[model samples]
Target: MAGVRPRAVVADDSHFMRSVISDILEDGGIDVVGQAKNGRDAVETVADLSPDVVTMDVEMPEMNGIEAVDRIMSENPTPVLMLSAHTDENADVTFEALDKGAVDFFTKPGGEVSMEMSRLEDQLVEMVTSVAEVDATAATGSEKQTSAPTSSTRTYVENPTLLIGSSTGGPKMVERVLSELPLEADFRVLIVQHMPDGFTERFAKRIDSRSDYDVREASHGDRIGGGEALVAPGGKHMIVSNYRSGRLRVKLTEDPPVNSVRPAVDMTMNSAAEVITDPLFGVILTGMGEDGAAGIKAIKAVGGRTIAQDEETSAVFGMPKRAIETGYVDDVLPIDDIPNGILNTAKAEVN
Candidate 1:
């Protein structure tokens, strides 16, 4: 591992956060090439140092993370990871950073930024190291431009559900796909994104701000509506279940982990299989593990459609590749083609 050390630039407004992130990076076999106190400094540092990865703090002063992300992506185009707090406002800004070009994000784990550092070392290191593998093309948002949906009256379907799952390299993948989709679209979208506790609510809001759909985090017993999208909360399992109201609703449970994660894609898909007698569709995107393979198989068994992100466009190629290998995926598409792929498939499948 001697010559394999990755280099990184750490950017954050909080002195304690910068110190903490830097320390974690160093301990994880990455060289701390530079440290910047604000967003402008982050952009400048990336240009000067050209580190393998950049960690951005979302609420930084001078230039916020979103601005720095745009500048760096437009100019330097390095793999950037953003840091977000548990606060609701920061969640919107945090995912906005991802949409602008930040690779992924991590939440400050504890309720307070206490002296506890061991809680984050492994997870932070793994994410930064995994993220460092992104090529300049993806960091610059290099997927081909797809036309955003123009004026349209989306006819709501009687039984339509879209399921999406992603992990590493997911934030941007999900954001881009959602942004290209018709705002106020006809179907319901459910997402199982691997994230720490307290982040998904804001992530949903961020996607909501950028799209026509009413995107929000799922709550127990919340029934998804037409033209609505729900993201599974961080610490619970989100399952689709039938309510007494004779419609599908989100059920958050404290169930044991599946595929080593609480909000596992397989769990949601399997649960959906039980409650949904409709046109269920699963779109599996980039991530590092085989978390969605079983879920895709489950969906396919139920006669639901499935799409896997192809290897060429996937950042890690692990999760989608596994799903594709299952022979359950009906389509394997690049990131840019996914939105249209889903739309066409939904129209063809749903009544």
Candidate 2:
């Protein structure tokens, strides 16, 4: 913690919450350069102070966090960390902020200030430090490309469907991959990330803004289409079903949690495997648990290809490592290579 001290701006409607966050950053050796009481102020503070990072709160008076994030990123792009209420409503706004270019977020505690701040101290510090690090690297134009296997090139499937699973550091990682995808790729993508309710819609919207693809939260009975990315709704399960024409459609379910998560990766991957006979591509990205391993197995069992993020590039290696350990992953790649792999696969499939 002795390197460059990260400077941050805290924006929230709650003065108490702002002070608590400022204290936590100070304790973590980060400089809280400024504070904002609303989204408009947050925007101006960012413009004036140009801090390395901003901790934003949703549902602020005057301008909301999502709108502010949009303005900040468009004008003077600074890394933002959204402060979300633990309620389902706030989670949605938080995800929207991310889609709008904020880096990540933390759920504010529901009750006492001391208890809540204590619980979130580590996460806040970690997110702030990480965003600052990424921004610094980006500013210096020294960000490294993802490391993937060069031995065997990836091959795509005909009429391929892409399935992705992630958690924890997923938002930024997913943004990086999706933003690089071709706008006209002839495949549909499905993503299942473990999150609280109300967040997935915002996450999908965020991705859509940055990506050429049409990204949205999956609705029950929604038809899957090429050039679209469907993010499973949080707190529910998203399954795949076959239409009469043999095309795939999404089915949202309230099924019991699998692998301790309702929107489990295994649930969606298994459903896709059952419905889609063609070669599919399953990707396991940065996350903290083994939720995707079983789903990856289902994909592999159906002769579909599987790829897992390598540990060096993972925020946490649990999910991908589990898939690799199961001997299901066809490739263990770094984050940068993932989009390329998918692209190469899509190209090979077409041929």
Candidate 3:
């Protein structure tokens, strides 16, 4: 037991894919204890093997990855990393799997079968290894809320700009925070959620369906408007351009990735700090890295406010912890309380 490696179950309908994934895991020091040909077999194999993690294919015969994720979460609750194709349809299904409790996802190189997957060897191994450390039960459970903070008097900043960044367990958290905001709040929001190119559009659509704010994927030269939110397109950096007609516009660039991810929080937040002279808010939620730390400092240097999701509620505390360490975060609140923190920061009377 002392020398035992973390075990995983690779589930895919393609025998070739199963072998490839198993080999990758083994090479990464993770033991592939079992393999499954379909979702049904995946469930049964997981039950029997009780592996530390699972790499699940999005599409399969006799059951799909989404269904398997639901069953696993409800029953065993092991960490699941989804393998999906980069298509509009697969994006929707992959999000469904995430909603059903998948820890994270890796976009397959070129559809269901491709030797191109070998190109993603490093990324795949990293994701699977990181996910195995997650507490699947906590990651999938409903968030607990606390009462909002209050003071005697209230003030507000009209038409404030809100910049949000997140990763890992971010989608559900982002949806929750945005949905809790008042429909009439005068905020121009820009969100940078670490995601793949084909997925951000659908991600924005899903958020818009449940949120009161007008949400859509950001396009180049898109003018910022109060009461609307724009999600940065994946695989590109979104930065604030010059102010025009009393509003700032966002520009998408193919610049090199920051912090190893395009559309990084720091990229957007740093740009917003330089252009937007209004009251700005930088919020870093649950994520696995220190992407937003410098952005937090940038915002605070310009007399803007910053908030971080507290570790107790964070699915992974990496980003928030790094931001908090900068001593620039004005409020550290739970996931449920974060919406209030953002709104309250704008409303809290200036001394």
Worst 10 residues of 2 by lDDT: 134-143
| Model 1 lDDT tens row, 304-337 | 9899998878877889999999989999998989
lDDT winner between candidates 1 and 2:
1
lDDT (Cα, tens digit) per residue for candidate 2, span 1-351: 468899999998888888999999989989999999999999999899989889888888999999999898888888787777776677666666766777667667673133568776876787677666444223223335553323245433446788999976688788778887765555688988777666777778878998878899999998866678889998889999763343578889998988777799999898898888766899999766689999889999988888999887775567889989999899888887888877766666334
lDDT (10s digit) by residue, model 3, range 1-351: 456688999999999999998998899889999999999999999999999999999999999999999999999999999999888899999999988999878889888886888888888887787678778988767766543333334456776889999998789889888887765556788999999999999999998997878999999999867778999999999999976444779999999999999989999999999998888999999888899999999999999999999987777788999999999999999888898888788884578
lDDT of candidate 3 at residue 69, scale 0 to 100 = 96
Ranking by lDDT, best first?
Answer: 3, 1, 2
> Clashes in each model (backbone N, CA, C under 3 Å)?
2, 4, 0
- TM-scores for candidates 1 onward, in order: 0.85, 0.66, 0.93
Alpha carbon lDDT of each predicted model: 0.82, 0.79, 0.88
* Ranking of candidates on TM-score, top first: 3, 1, 2
What lDDT is reached at residue 22 by model 3?
A: 93
Candidate 3 yields a Cα-based lDDT of 0.88
